[model samples]
Target chain A: MSDANEAANEPIAVIRTPISLDYHYSAGQSASRFLRAIAQGKLLGQKCPVDGRVYFPSRGACPQHGVTFGDEVVELSDKGTVVTFSIVRVPSENIPLELPYITINVLLDGADTILIHVLDAKLEDVRMGMRVQAVWKPKEEWTTSTANILYFRPIDEPDASYDSYKEHI
Target chain B: MSPTLEKALTAPHKLEYTYKRSLGPVLSPFFTALRDRRILGVKRRDGRVMVPPKEYDPDTSESLDELVEVSDEGVVTSWSWVATPRRQQPLDRPFAYALVKLDGADTAFLHVVDAGDEGNMETGMRVKARWADETTGMITDFVFVPA
Candidate 1:
């Protein structure tokens, strides 16, 4: 650091300005198909030809297979078993939800991959292998966005067997 | 397949930032011209004038000393059409983004032309600077328009 006397001796003009650049991003092929299915209150998954593993919110290509899944998408059930979760108690300005919300990774029925979403259940009530279903918003408000399904909530059924989702965890 | 998903869709995104730049002795006068609604260029030892004047010559790396006034009017050397203007662009409507060689200056300056349509824009077309109502010591203080 320079001394105050040395700083005063140097001659320079400091120009401070603000800049904002706006962009329009295009969601690629696989995500586009997944988002379209979400608008219709449906869930879609894609399977890798090589490993034969199913990925929700289709990635279009499998890194393992090194091949693109062109028009080879599969339908997935909305019901799922929670593999893991974290209770968010810390309040942040960017989080639109209220405090003490539980965010969980659910392994949907017949899906090899897990989907991360907010689960509307009491923090103490949320447990691993808890069965949950998607709660869709009104059809009129549907758009090509995942927001169509508001959030996941527990069904009135018994907890799922750990063996069913242990591999996913 | 849903018709909406048959093709690509665009989503809005914004990046915001503030930048601060320190100007040294050689380039200070160039930006000061923008404040006074004037334009200045630096002359190299070989007598070539560079607009938006640089401190040193590009070829010889010699320190530039002489600053000369260049006419705001210039000829458009090359240009491309912006059918859909992006946010914060100089103009809200269609315009031409061009590299203009200002009069008495050897180098070209990058700016936009407010020509009504692409058909109206052509090579060697004359353009003059359109100053803003209020002056600020920034390159965006003025833009080029058909003269």
Candidate 2:
């Protein structure tokens, strides 16, 4: 026990455990309608009856007024402005992208909320107020998952004015 | 939307964290003993031994270092029957998760017991450790079995 070399030679116990939880996730009424539309290459949002603010991929209720949105579904544009973003340098098993990719919080046009998604562009090219458009996967590969939209990419449109989406950030 | 498609979209999702961690101090030797088909416990201030030893006393928060050997055979103090096993459970078939108080140890250790049937599981039932074919200093190195 007193020998430092002996302690260093001893095998330290290490546990390599991969923990996992598998369950069926039911996307409720609002998300179901949104996913259904997105499968068809359309973005759906719910208009708040009180403030008339549109929530993209709505949670079926307005958080501010706590009012349930009925069939007031509004189609939103795939184009959006990058309000904020981060460069992910670490590798993950789930994300297929290369190292150092940009993940952006986009404020989609006609929607009052932001959608957190990956932006496919050079690291130095991504910026706040940068206009980006959704890049969809092939039609045949579309499913009930938001992953159907591969990622957003910088478009040729002008950068959105700071005052336009200032309240969102 | 069509009535069939209107049903809420449901999909199977699996959340996982795959990582390796070092079993430091007390647990390192405890799990290392399990690899050699032996059970070790920590001696508390009152001399009562705790199986699956902790580095610090739970009540007094005193650092403990005295490691004691305990018998693999023990009595099931309590148990809950698992009629159907989940994907990550130690056993693939039906089993009982029991708190076993090993001989010479005061604290009960939580582990799965393969009693063959739910009807065989009961408080005070004697169980013995069934070692895995290959041991790697992990808790899954052995499971409990009706003695």
Candidate 3:
């Protein structure tokens, strides 16, 4: 063995290994209901009795109200305003989607929480407060997964005013 | 538990972590042998052997590099029966996770013992390495079975 100085430059054998772990997750109360609604081509939101704010992909409990609304589920509209968006151009092996895709965080009608999904439109056409609607997959392809909606696309309506979605941003 | 909540929809989900890691100098040799169906142990200053060898002595700070070959057959020092195996475990059925002392080794290594059921697992029971159909130099390359 050499001294610390010599050891610093010593050749070492390095072994590279790839590790993969798999798990089965239980989608608890709220998530289970939300997924079921997606499977049926509908959007469900849960309201907080204390704040009167509804959350899409219902959080089983309300953080602001500090209460649980097990029986206070509400249906939400598919259309939403894009609170924000980013244009992704860098290609990566890990990402499943195509390059140059637009990712947007949407605040659905009647819901307080934002839903993140890809925007099916050109980067030049997307802007803050842009109204987009969920384009669902064919009925045969419907399942209890967020994949039920292919992507959100621009609707025939005008862009929402910045003040309308400022709180969400 | 709330009684008013309706029955929610359920679906199967698979979770995975995609990554790679490098095993340093000491343990690298141990796993490399596993790829070739062999076992290596590290020798301590007192001459006792440690299987699944570590880079440093647990009792002393001395670096250990003496590699010693040990027989795969070993005795189970302790064990606990798992009735229901979790996902991604070595075996999909029942098995005992045991501390095994291999021949020529002083320390025990934690590994699974495939004894079919808890009734067949006992302290001092002799077991041997049952290699996987395909080896990849990982700790999961083999499990122990009754010798």
On the 0 to 100 scale, the lDDT of residue B111 in model 2 is 96
Best by TM-score: 2
Over 4 Å off, model 3:
A1-40, A58-61, A68-75, A86-95, A143-145, A155-158, B1-6, B61-63, B82-89, B92-94, B116-122, B132-134
TM-score of each: 0.52, 0.87, 0.74
Model 1 residue runs over 4 Å out of place are A1-21, B1-5, B15-147
Candidate number with the higher TM-score (1 or 2): 2
Considering summed lDDT, which 10 consecutive residues are worst modelled in model 2 chain B? B1-10
lDDT of 3 by residue, B107-131 (tens): 8999999999899999999999999
Clashing pairs in 1: none
Query: For candidate 1, lDDT tens digit of each residue in B14-79?
Result: 776755676666566776666677888999888889997998888888888799999999999999
Candidate achieving the largest DockQ: 2
Extract clashing residue pairs from model 3. Answer: none
When sorted by TM-score, best at the front, the candidate numbers are: 2, 3, 1
Residue B113 in candidate 2, Cα distance off native in Å? 2.2
Identify the candidate with maximal lDDT: 2
Arranged by lDDT with the best first, the candidates are 2, 3, 1
